[model samples]
Target: MVPMMMLAAIMSPSAQAQPAAATIESRAREVVALLGGTGDYDATFAPSFRTAVPRARFDAIAAQLQQALGKPTGVAAIEATGPWAAQIRIAYDGGTLNADLTLDPGGSHQIIGLLAKGAEPRGPAAQTLDAVVEQLAAQNGTSVFALARLGDGSPRLEKARNATTPIAIGSAFKLVILAELVRSIEAGERKWSDVVTLDGSALPGGGYAQQPKGTQIALRELAERMISVSDNSATDILLFHLGRAKVEAMLPVVGFTDGGVRNVPFLGALEVFKLKGVDGGALGTRYLAMDAKARRAFLDGPVRDTPIAAIPRDLFQNGKPLRIVELEWFASPNDLIRAMDWLRRHMDGTAGAELRAILSKNPGLPDATKHWRYVGYKGGSEPGVLTMTFLLQAGNGAWYALTAGINDPARDVDTLKFTGLMNRALDLAAPR
Candidate 1:
């Protein structure tokens, strides 16, 4: 949250006489209405307006003000100048005349004050915001991303890392699950307190929530764990309960097409779906090994005209071989951004507040009091894959949507290093 400061400079009445109080008040009220009623005066508008106009030029200010106020919501006001200042205002429907505003002097548009209308002051001055963003972008390395600042329900600084290129996004697809759960709860399909028991036999290797198989947990708890802690067991159970078909059916409504849980018991499903060389006689053998060289050669070689094995029998109960399945859990950057945008708008107060609480409790956060920014992320990783997607909210109301993915097969590279690089890139896109 940014700080709010209303500077009051008392100017003595001029001996030459000034405009009538009624006229001033009338103009002020008119300006207010033109700018979307009294509510248009938000924190985001103050600094820009203050910088663009001086109190002395009431008529000129009033004319330019009307134009600024007349634009539709989320559309930035065109730059205008008055003898004393430069200003911009964004109107929104909310409490008081809240704003994320900036002001600068008329002579050179030197920053005078940068404050939110009702919140506490954040440190960056208005004049430095753009520079900070540019500096950060120059320092980061992720391939595709976007940064946006929400003020009065509008996104400011909505810039894509590579205007058109799309990158593969990994685990970040879990946000889709979160969205579906919220929608289901909102639609009265389920309750947050509804309890669901976990079947331990369903836990995947190397994932959170692999223990206490029969433990009962609420549906909402599973949703939270799947996202906040990246718990696979909770995710698997939720997927099963929600049903793969039901979840996939909601993607179009959420503005997503290429991402969703494609298979139940994802790991096992993938093994079954992509069966290539596993033999039927290998059933019940937990320790079977195939040469890495041979596997790679087979994977890279040309395809044969003969029908490939689609299922491996004797691998599971019922004498049925596992079916090959591919979970649609990754997405292109464009689709990922659209999905995140939807989440930002649809995230209800309860879920958003809960996530905030969880993030505050995360032990990985640094102890520094400089106000660590809040970022909610859902990530997915596997051997030969790394993916992360997040919505970062700065204390100043600046927000960014970021997605990064690497499919390189080299397992030696550090995952933390990759994640750090993504974070650094986001910091550049939306600085504190």
Candidate 2:
């Protein structure tokens, strides 16, 4: 956590000086051009040089660009090009435009260049992006996760954990449900005030949220519970309303291939079964025969498989036994960043306000703020699986994407201890 003294020092009035108009204009134009637009450039130049630009700002910028560009653009695909420079690209009406910008120590900055069409990057920025990806892949994990930051339209750090391999997102998959709920509300399919009842049977064992019997809650309140509290009952209820088929069908539209929620809420164990008797009857046969060996195979496999039993055949499986049903909630580091990008784009509108309301209600903030700086996150845990991902908007506009998952075959691993370690990793990953 940034010390209170430091926070005060950074927030002090003297530290708050607007950059020269030329510099601000340059940066603004660069940001607009990178976003493929030049309209309504509203930005706040923080007084404290030490103050990181709020993640909310980046989200706002992304949202504006999406509105201008009329489609989803690569807002999170930004990376640092130098100690103080970055690059990004935005898809425009008929083509793509790339912009590179640089920030000076005094917050004075310039939009170095804006290409009419997207250009293939070369030189230092590209090299830096490649290097970051390699470094993330080398982390002590079996899965692949990468994060990139673009300044002035140049790639800085595109690091990956395993890069090529995919892992189960576990409870992080709830984000998909959250996104769907938001979409439904926006489409008039549902309303925030629509009351949904939660029954005891909907609860997942060992998960957070006590099963409140016959509890009546608004759909929006349930969405908040699903995300802020990681409530299994809320998620199950939302999933039922959204319909497994509708949710599964939406993944491809968002550039996800390997994520989808199973009809069953807690299918962690059932995911490994290639074939299981629906009733677990006499004709039943476990796909891998042994859970231990099956888990080993899953961990070792280059591409993880989602069991048909976990996701129903009619909803997800297209007939093949090993047909993968990637849950929208399961995000790679890139996926998390993408989701954050999406959230950032919608943050300025009703959707953004709703998300902010939900985020403010998250329980992790009070405790997590103790050691971390600018932590906006959603985490989920269950036996054998622990997942947490965040879009850590740094004290500078610099942002870091952190997702940590541990599929511990040994159920003895301490969750609190693991969360602490993950926090440490996040600290290390944050800009000094």
Index of the highest-lDDT prediction: 2
Which parts of model 2 are misplaced by more than 4 Å?
1-145, 150-157, 197-215, 258-331, 363-374, 410-417
Model 2 agreement with the true structure over 1-432: per-residue lDDT tens digits:
010011011222333333333343445444544344333233423332212223343444444335434543334344343443444444444323344433443433322222121222222221243444443334333434455453333223455564333455556766666776767776777777888766644233212235466877787777776776455556767776677556655554343444323322223223223233233321123333335446345423411233233433232112111212222124455555555555544456656677757754542422344444455677654334455666556666665555655444333123333443454455456565
Write the residue-wise lDDT of candidate 1 on 144-185 in tens digits.
Answer: 444555444434445555423433344455666666776777
Kindly give the stretch of ten consecutive residues in candidate 1 with the minimal lDDT sum: 317-326
Q: Per-candidate RMSD vs. true structure?
A: 23.0, 20.1
Residue-pair clashes per prediction, in order, are 37, 43
Q: Model 1, 43: alpha-carbon shift in Å?
A: 57
Q: Report the error of model 2 at residue 100, Å.
A: 44
- lDDT, candidates in the order shown: 0.43, 0.45
